[model samples]
Target: MKTNPPAVQIVAISADEAGQRIDNFLRTQLKGVPKSMIYRILRKGEVRVNKKRIKPEYKLVAGDEIRIPPVRVAERDEQTVSPKLAKVASLADAILYEDDWILVMNKPSGTAVHGGSGLSFGVIEGLRALRPEARFLELVHRLDRDTSGVLLVAKKRSALRSLHEQLREKGMQKDYLALVRGSWPSHLKVVQAPLLKNILQSGERVVRVNSEGKPSETRFKVEERYAHATLVKASPVTGRTHQIRVHTLHAGHPIAFDDRYGEQEFDRQLATTGLNRLFLHAAALTFTHPNSGEVMRMEAPLDERLKQCLKVLRQQAQ
Candidate 1:
């Protein structure tokens, strides 16, 4: 089950107006929410600046985002707040697949799986509200914030339990599409390494290859090549956290557009090629139906922006 994330909707508080701090500006924008609630979200990391969370006194940039985590609202007041929530509610309702027991979505690049670090609401909560009849709706898995593609959600408690069991038992197949940093070796490389996570003092977490960590495996195959990089299909046989991201990096072909786990020279090369938003997508997923005994496969169509970027990069190569 997912809860409402911390978040705030943006309204113009003019640059010429009395200097109001970011939290104060939120106090102005969200009329009914309490100041104490605002402070709690900030401290817990549910609210973010841009997409990154910040300190309580962080100055207001003209276009900064102030996320308000979800509040326990009076159902009676929903009508009253609907007007204020119209924009986000509409955008958050996008669905990729829906059935009585399952839901899948083509999540956008900037949204999180659920809220924290000051997000008021995330896609999951918005979806849950839109389908309240569901006894339970749980994310079957996760994708990174800046990577877009298919995500699965289970709509019933039984379904969620069964699906999660399948994942734990390694009864699922996951395939990803990644535009990578450099021309890949023509031969396929199946990186079998263990991943160890490191959390920095600043509260960010990243993963690295370590002999003592959880065993991980990634099968990488070149799909196509550009002058400087290659588009590869990565299939993970094991799902330790950040398995694919770390494996690809260890293979010497880090994913293009990856903000973390990317090498510096390759990151710069990606910018020159006009690639953005970590060129990775949950392209296909296969698992057994939690309700039925049959197999199911799900795929997401390539979004056009990535396609256009590839076309331009191919042109540059020529």
Candidate 2:
């Protein structure tokens, strides 16, 4: 007698999904599968991205192949999960991009990458709970806890691999919009600085510029101006920790609502501006498809907070 091989789920990926994780991909695909079970399978080498067993947090690129094992039910003595996980799982309906290989969400501010330090649940954790059979789901890039827009998630490992290469080559382009201080001096400007890590006693040990730091750069241009400030469009040429935030301050003009590096007095004046969520947004992104080499672009609409701030600014001008 011959035995049959377990049914496999195979998928091909694309580049618009350049930055996503493996585990997050599966959760979206297999909305019925539980996160704990998926994590267990990944740890045991049951899932493969291009035939290599990748961790749950493995980043994805396009054109890679994925293999998923047959699902099986196993009784475990694990404890019950928290209700917050269940709540986050329901947010999957907000997906902006989805294919066999990936799904990207417009990640809102105030969310963490994963559950750690103090957060027991994040966008990824909740998504995993909702997607069960998806063999992989992963985050391609990261956003600050208080920054909103254009978050990427990979549906499979192969897709993760293809998308990542574009990021490495700097073929991916991302643009941001911010309400900043003062009239920008130039129509086009690039802020080049070196970043160093500071060991802080209480606040975040953030990356800052110093004499002995890594080289970083950001480009900026004016979009509009307020009575005491300027609304600028900014782009980062190199992906570094806090590259934009640090460079903006390094130029003596901080973002309007920056709570950390922002001028407190300026932030206070902008209070009526209704810019509650750090005045930074991932406005647009463009990159070559990892699979087809075709160019792809995705834009995030201005959220309510920013819109409200714009309304106030316009009203103030009138």
Candidate 3:
């Protein structure tokens, strides 16, 4: 029913493949191989770039040769539409903006941007399935699985490069609405801290403020103050993994229902009020269009669930 592929194969990186992480490239190249196997091969130096061992995080460059050692791979099942992805297929209706070179959508919460880590499929996979005619589509940026908001996708390589430049230059602006656990100080507006990332023995990632860390900054402005929670608009000046969550924790006001960086007791109390998910949302994004060079601003309204939670909180305060 299954047969091993060639014992070994060499691949030359193409311009479109350049800048992609080696691990992802392996996943695509070695279809049907488990992710663990891919990582194991990398650890054992079984995979090489230009005849030298490279780590999983290595970014491929155009014309670089990759040496892949063949291992038995199970025959992949025929592609079928995942029932769970049926909803993902509907993301086309949520399009906020689209053009020849760019696409934007109001990504729903509880949906991963891409499929991995036990997920069968995600937004990107779903979109690809829905638009079979699209030749090139790639996420320009990422949002957490549980964060709802405006998401940008590039439809061309040149657009992706230009937008990445904007992000690196900090010219792209993102605003988020978050409900924090405590009353935020009116005078406390700016948070400048250094964040360090740590991977626990269990493979869980965590970010915290540490002296020996990368410089990070976030600007907070109170939008609404509740009895036990405060609604704030957060603008991160430096993009880092979990920068907003870590910075909020550093300010002694972790976001409400933020299981990772929040206080369990506080979260439990809020959980009793029908709030089941984190209350952080990507409210808006502003950037210069990569193709047109015109300034563009996109906004995603708070989802009904988040809006209902705020309504309940305000009613209680009244």
**Candidate maximizing TM-score:** 3
Tens-digit lDDT track of model 2 for 136-205? 8788777777777777777778778888887888888889887877766774488899999786886475
lDDT of 1 by residue, 218-282 (tens): 88888888878888989988877777878888888888767788777876876755566778888
- Candidate 2 residue spans exceeding 4 A from truth: 1-90, 201-203
Off by over 4 Å in 3: 1-82
lDDT accuracy of residue 233 in candidate 2: 81
Single out the weakest 10-residue window by summed lDDT for candidate 1: 84-93
Q: Cα miss at 189, model 1 (Å)?
A: 2.8
Write the number of the candidate with greater TM-score, choosing between 1 and 3.
Answer: 3
Cα lDDT tens digits, model 3, 56-80, are 6789999999999987643433135
Model 2's alpha-carbon lDDT is 0.75
Candidate 1: C-alpha RMSD to true structure equals 15.5
TM-score for each predicted model, relative to the true structure = 0.70, 0.71, 0.73
The residue pairs that clash in candidate 3, if any, are none
RMSD of each: 15.5, 10.4, 14.2
